[model samples]
Target chain A: MSTIFAHGGQLAHGVLLTMLMTVLGFGCALVAGVVLAVFHISPVPPLHRLAVGYVAVFRNIPLLVWLVLFVFGLPEIGLLYPLFGTVTAAMALYWAAFICEAVRSGIRTVPPGQIEAARALGFGFSQLLRHLVLPQAVRSMVQPLGTVFIALTLNTSLAAAVGVRELTGETQFFTITYDIPIPAFAVTTAIYVLITLAGGLLTGRLERKLAFKR
Target chain B: MNTGASTLFDLPGPAGRRRIRIATVVSLLLIVVAVVAVVRRLTTHGMLAADEWRVFTQWPTIRFLLGGVWATVLVTVVAMAIALPAGALVALVRLSRARVARALGRAYVEVFRAIPLLLLLYMFLFGLPRLGLTFPVFWQLTLAIVLNNAAVFAEILRAGILAVERGQSEAASSLGMTYWQAMWLVVIPQAVRKVVPALVGQSVRLLKDSSLGYVVSYLELLHQSQVLGEYYHTVLPTYLVAAVVYIAINITLSRFAHLLENRGLRGVRRRRHPESTALAENAAIGSGGRAPLIDDSTV
Candidate 1:
């Protein structure tokens, strides 16, 4: 793995870029997810239909196609965005459907009794959600959200298709071009494993911490 | 609707309805504007021109992509052929009473599950040849998909096994059956029924994930599309065609999974008596949780 040392700083930067993409993608997903979840649970039939339609189309299409569309088709349509930005945006849009589902599931887990208690106490819609429903929903959301984020990390590799030098792309460049396939892939895979395992461990701990209230 | 007390929101009054109508109008307008803008841009780029559209009639390119489709189907079948048995074995070992086997299985599942399938493909393709072990491009892609998907499938099976009630084995033991007999006959059958939808879902993902076979120069559907695009200078339509093709495959797979799930549900419903309706309800809840597919394609 000395080749790892040889490209030490570059590999570290690649890891950082991958992490950044994941965080950005996840951040976008959270915003879109909340909005979509709101639309899904909205009383307005049209809003609900819109949310359902969005999730249906986005969820079924592959992210690679999204990447292709954004990278090539967008510019043809005169939409200008950086390569990295476009890819992360595509990932966010794709993954937000998943996050929306998780949030919807969490909202469902809020017991009828709790909702009733909040209503009887004269809690308004936002107040009831904030104080009673959402707090409880948080406990149920940790595991699924964690899974989605980990998968998002894996998906950052898709950026390579559009020439973004994230971890997988960097590893590939070193392997195929630099002829250090074994060492580069080993190092890169190790980092991915470590990051994912650590994320899993954190989520497990979070689940346990939330276990009591549930 | 107004009679029920609510948590998220109360029923909208006339004012609220007006506001919702406005919001709905605005959202619909936004969608229309976006579509119109994209369509205008496409026209400006001559994407709808007869010359640009000519790629569709290019017999050579169509044949190439069709060949790629053939390669894709072949890879998925062969890979799953290997992965299914491997995953089953790993899941069984993980479910075993032996601590060592369980630990090994856990490690295998977690490690591989954490690693991206694309990285795994690269590892096998570029990494293997260095150790004086070369494989045909087809076998290389197949091995990569098999190895990674096996790990994912193992976890899916393990979870399914755990979801099953413990009393199944206990009843088997009382009937003088060994652990293996209980697992193979009683526990596994139930678990398999519960997990069938998930397994089929993962197969759809496998079909999509195999698109990464492009990177290794395997002439899969995506790669052939890329080649066609470069040749025809019609990147947009070429990739759009590829996307449509991929979508078609994915939709078909999910439909098959949906069909399998319904048939399985019918079987479960037919077998369960009124007293065991609780069991049927539990199956419904458990199966609603989608099976974890290997990659991001599990929708």
Candidate 2:
């Protein structure tokens, strides 16, 4: 049991991996989400349909299933990979669908008058999107995006199934090795609670700041 | 932002058309590439072995999956049953005149809401034994779901309750109802109606999140799928089936909610609007008013 904490370095390594996955996956999801939201709200009929379908499928399917499909199912045809990359890619893809919808909702909340104003000011499509639409949309998006980030952080725990030594995986390893499930898991839960609370606090402050700006 | 319908198609002529065409082609090409990559991978690896496919058809896996479905349903129903009442209580507590009760209610909500559902399940399953409390797998899972979901539902219900007109509560009190009676009989009824859509939405979420039980080795659908995958080494098919089952169930539930929402609105109109009620009653009286009376009373 003493050996578990004695090897605190291993736990730190796991925490590092967890943070890396959260940042990378969420970063990718944000970019993909913005792009998809643009397409979804665009005047192009085909793009709109495609974006809708993408959201429907990904949003409906379980994230674990997506992870399995990428890790186990994808390699069958020859797209082999290191497990880490596969799991990360899968997480990014799955969350991208959700984030896209959030961004779209945010974008929709921007009044049409704002867009019209931008147009009347002689703004082109790109300019209007960059200057007027995106800034307001992003403001409205702060709260939802914060929730998504927390979700992404929590969901990264699922990557443990694919053998990524994230915090959960490390806790599992210590539990099995020490044969003391309670203490190991207690520590894990505490860590999770701490991180989530910090996130909530930070996001709450940001939300207030954004509201004040408006 | 009413940009008007004409703005949708008012692109800047030939160059704009050409650019749009190029953009469409590029997006399509990207999707095609991704699809081809996925298809190529799926076909080559032969995800399910022949024997594994046979095993999936076997009675035990079938029974297990079906049993998992039942467990999932039971857990959801029981959890929501508990959560609804518990959530209402918590909401009432939060809205109570007493500061201590409100603080306690608010604390419970914040703590539970911030904690991930999966971690809560783990705590219930593994943590309780140390404190000399034990529950069977089903109860443990159900309790975890209820606790986590109640926190969320409490918030939702409180929002709904707050959305109700302050006059409604005052009116109930003015009519000689006690605070509790006013809450339960008047405030809650209206609040529930307003929150029906969101309640259904959360129920769908609960159904999906129940899959998290797999982590604690609860034999829900995902757990059943994992077992089959371990046995037959057909990880993908088993999960695919589970995913499809979940999606099908949720879609059906959502459609039902939509139907109920439409019916409920109609019901509200017929009951609340005296003019509509009179018209409906008159139309019914011409054809025997019993049916409309029954409908109106039900609403």
Q: Which is the leading candidate under lDDT? A: 1
Which portions of model 2 miss their true places by more than 4 Å?
Answer: A1-11, A113-123, A179-186, A212-214, B1-26, B47-64, B273-299
TM-score chain B for all models.
Answer: 0.87, 0.80
* Residues A76-118, model 1: lDDT tens digits: 6568788899899999998998788777767777777778877
Give the per-residue Cα lDDT of candidate 2 at A9: 86
Best by TM-score: 1
State the lDDT at B214 in candidate 1. Answer: 71
Q: What is candidate 1's TM-score against the reference?
A: 0.90
Shift in Å, residue B159, candidate 1: 1.0
Output the lDDT of residue A105, model 1. 68
Candidates in order, TM-scores: namely: 0.90, 0.83
